[model samples]
Target: MREKLQHVAGRVWLYPHDPDPEAIGACVGVIADDRGSVLIDAGNSPAHAREVQQAIAAEGLPAPRWLVYTHHHWDHTWGAAAWPDVEVVAHSSAVDLLTAEAERPWSHQYLRDQVALDPKLGPSFRARALAVPDFGELAIVLPHRTFDDALTLPTGVELRHVGGSHAPDSIVALDPGSSVLLVGDCYYPPPFHLRTDDDGPDLAMARRLLAEKHAVSVDAHSAPRSGS
Candidate 1:
């Protein structure tokens, strides 16, 4: 019900914390420039995506030049196809993971189960999803271009692959102009049930890198964290 877009610095904008009921997924970030804007992550549903799009336009910015995904989770990728025409960009494995999930029974069940489990989301998200009945329509638009490692935008935005905790395919976008690093679902607090493929070394390594980085860093669905 209550959604906020926080201007961390320069041109970086983050929505309410990713875990918020209204968000229903990770946080949303917007990176804008004179040429065009870039969406850090798509929301979880059509309604969610619409809100994100509206928020951007409300800011008087044009449609995003690219919709860069942090990972392939349903909360991040499901609403992608709902977005206005923009090139989707992601790690090759992210697209593969998206395609693979489309074929899984559990993927569809996540909706039904979440409604039964998460009280806040049930009324707003599940009820609406039930009204539609065609769960398959949520099929996302796949990334047109794939990259193995880092990809630099023509506009000079740099996205670096950062190891993740919630999922295997996490990456961070570096906006030099904004002096911000967007760590999408890459850092999670403790006592969490979500499991990651990474063991001790890689996850620890990622943490070290994040700590050493000097730019202000924000999680996929969080407020701006100080660079220190």
Candidate 2:
């Protein structure tokens, strides 16, 4: 919960992830150009989103005109509602799951009930929810736009769906201007919520890496790795 936005390059700024296991949060990116600015992920809650906005504003950065999701996970998509003015975008496959979450009441009790019934909604997830100033203010905003394969923004950012074990609907955003690839959590193992030991996605990801021959692989939760 600190003002930690780091400039990656040209038009890319990264808000690094919070390392606390109990209330983890993923990295977020801001890519801006004359056409418009785009937010890579919405953060974990309304407060988290607000903090990002404030950080950008404090630095005199352009306010994001679009918010994109890498996948439909609480840590990534829960703060969508905070950026009401920006259009929310995600992969086509993420719509159903996100829409279902959007229908749920935004309250601590509701989340507690879900935790009791679903192992996937584990304690770590709940801890983050509790960290929110007002859990009732939590909201799941659905995507305003979606793409099956790729979408090229006016700013020259490319978003491509690259399904992986972490989340099938995972998408990576590449800022051509900066050569920064926002891979979200796709490179990581299934999160704590899923609690699985499946490495199938890892193998598939390796194959994808070989097929594309990417120069480097940047994970949302970890440092960049050499794709070579």
User: lDDT of each prediction vs. the true structure?
Assistant: 0.69, 0.78
Tens-digit lDDT string for candidate 1 (64-173): 88888988766677668777777888887787778887775533467667657755445445534532345666666778877878999876878777645556677878
TM-score of 1: 0.78
Question: In each prediction, how many residue pairs overlap at the backbone (N, C-alpha, C within less than 3 A)?
Answer: 3, 0
The model with the greatest TM-score is: 2
